[model samples]
Target: MTKSDFYRLCGGTFFVLVSNARKPIQSKAECYNGITSGLTEPEALLALAKTVIPDIPKPMNSEMKTLKDNTRDFKACLSNGGGFFRFGDQAVLKSFDVRVRQDYKQPLAAMNDFMDEFLDIKTSTKKDEYLVKGLVELLDADKEIGNDEIFYVRADGSTMTKSQILTASELCVQPFLLGLWHYVLTVVRDNKVGKDTYKDFCPPRGGAERIYTKQLGENSKREIAITYCDIDKTDNDFTEPKEHIPGENEENRAYKENDTSSANEEAASVPGTVINNNPFFLNISGGNNSIYNHVDKVEINHEARRDKGE
Candidate 1:
């Protein structure tokens, strides 16, 4: 379906009642102010299941709760990815991420295909207008290129045609944002950064960032430029190695006291840098060994509702 058609279809499926309320009227009310006047439970559930793009099994009470939870989780994912998206933010990016992560064995490939189809439908019509100019204007304005306005001129004349916008968003914005989310959630969350160095190694918040889309020659070879300033090394620097004392284990104590072999090996392994791989040995401040560097992964996922105390 085309973009408008897709939205209309989604909008029309509002009667699908997947809720905790068992009674028909309660379900109806919960669904949407008694909109599902004649829809039966089975029908409502089927529609609800269908409403989900790339449908999965029917949501039960707990699953319905999970869907609601997914909706909540989407925002935090978006925020962690890159603050927010202007339009179709959660619907396109987070929705795809959640569905693929929950059901598909491989998410990135599936998400890429999903976005491709999404853009194809949305951008079927091409205007003779100079699309690249609007694209540059949007990037110059530092606006989040969205799905619908993914094409067409905005009030400020700073938006690309659907085709150009989609290419830029997928290549530049989605990868960086989604990859940041994945890295933060999977890599940093799994104790990969060592508990002792957590405080020091946590990614610094905010940076001078820039992104732009470019077309090469008349062949329409498009590329996106992404740039960001590195965090100042002088502020809360993590590279400086602290003196590490040995642990209670006699072997470790002995190694620390007498063995320069491992240190030599590590230095050789990573030329021009000192190694502090041992967590128990670092000389960070007391009572802060297990303290996380940034917000907890679980907390980031669940923080939307919790922050509101809901």
Candidate 2:
């Protein structure tokens, strides 16, 4: 009865509502793979909810963070081997409810991967490696490189095609993390981990001390599962369409506001390459302890339905 909402839009664009809808589907096989992995309905919800960073809903003014806003903080940190502290309210929600936790180390590792993704940039759709660091290698007299074709945006004032974006994302690939995802699925197969620990599989939010760190070394392997976020299927009791394609509903795509034509046009004139630096570290401050309010809400709904014999 506590329906999770997925918002989409007109342009072919999307974003995951990690608070309610976490698993955004990126491929067809990943869809079927999610079903066969023995993930129960609640298990799936718990898995998705783990990434639900507690914040109200979002900024009252839907005014988005410009590229400057998005990259400035991270860029500043990146200057001195990215040294600094992040202490601020999460901008997602309306009010500063939960204290934001900042893990400096995690973002540092992710930055290394982020820079790697910029290299060996390939056509996102194709498996071939297209050399992402071409522009960096050019080392023109100009210190900052202009928008290279390898960037996710397009040179023609349009967004990069889906395939192009995929190719560019490879620059983010951390060989240390290579096949780390596939291993997680196998761990779930062996029951080494349950949905509760699923979030740990991806990047640093999973926990402290990155798996790629000296801790993991050669013998370190873990369970990982790829979750698909079907816009309509927040709770699994509902029947899934034969094909669980994303964006089926244009009006309710997850994070649909990601489209940035205005930003793209304005950024074309701007110079300097900005490394992506979204921090996923845990918040030290404690507030509304229960990110699982949705879980309680679901129980209330179930009780109400039973009273009505629904």
Candidate 3:
């Protein structure tokens, strides 16, 4: 049977096989939680098969015998570093095969791609406020800002360590969601990174999106928060005018008017500031100041150069 078929019939049981060599624990045909405290990996496999087909031995024929004989071999392969032990599902196997073949410099690159897809497909349905809050919890930038740490790494090699990126005045905070998504995806997909990490690495997109996203978000909030913070600080002096109080008069209004005019002038004169409602200049800040520089244009006259052959 194919690996996917094996998983479908056997659940993802690993421990039961190794633990119980003689008395194979019968699986109640339940979805494998990837846990087998009292059971061995082989037993878990048996449990998984039973879950899929009540009378697995009768239907599976000689396959059941083959599984029983390979119990020791499976345990050994897993104990030794033989890469991930995959079973059940062609798409899952194919996706992993492709991921393995791709040359990724970053340790978490494949996981990040998976996560980006997950976020693009699943998290898009969430409300703006929920997404914003979810991002804050997931990245932990605010907490990390207080401690002064690197927030998260981008695929481009840049890091979001400072409180500035978290601020609305600086990078607008949304772009960093991509980074957080990458981090969570890696942690969840790799069994080495998490307990039962390999479990549900490629769950059905529509059927399990909410449950998976929520789990990943909740699990990753504290770690991400340690690296990033949302400060929203800006250098602009503009402030909203206060409402008139009982003692306030036209004199107060005149002062407020003057302040507004001066602030406008200051904002206009700021170097590298974009004109007329363009958001592109929003990236210009202390960290990115050096990126903007003037290049001198020299006008060369071709007629002024005489041919040496002449």
lDDT of 2 by residue, 258-283 (tens): 44444445555644322222223222
Model 1: per-residue Cα lDDT over 151-221, one tens digit each: 21221213344345446632232222223223223322221222212112122246531111121111233
Which runs in model 2 stand beyond 4 Å of their true positions? 1-60, 65-105, 108-131, 138-310
Per-residue CA lDDT of candidate 3, range 37-115, in tens?
4344444444322211222342145455555545433332222112222333344434433332342122233323222
Q: C-alpha displacement of 222 in model 1, angstroms?
A: 14
- Candidate 1: the clashing residue pairs are 151-162
Cα lDDT of all candidates, in order?
0.30, 0.23, 0.33
lDDT score, candidate 1, position 84: 20
Each prediction's number of clashing residue pairs = 1, 24, 30
Better of 1 and 2 by TM-score: 1
lDDT of 2 at 267: 53
Candidate number achieving the greatest lDDT relative to the actual structure: 3
RMSD of each: 28.3, 31.2, 28.4
Instruction: State in Å the error of residue 117, model 2.
Output: 12
lDDT of 2 at 219: 24
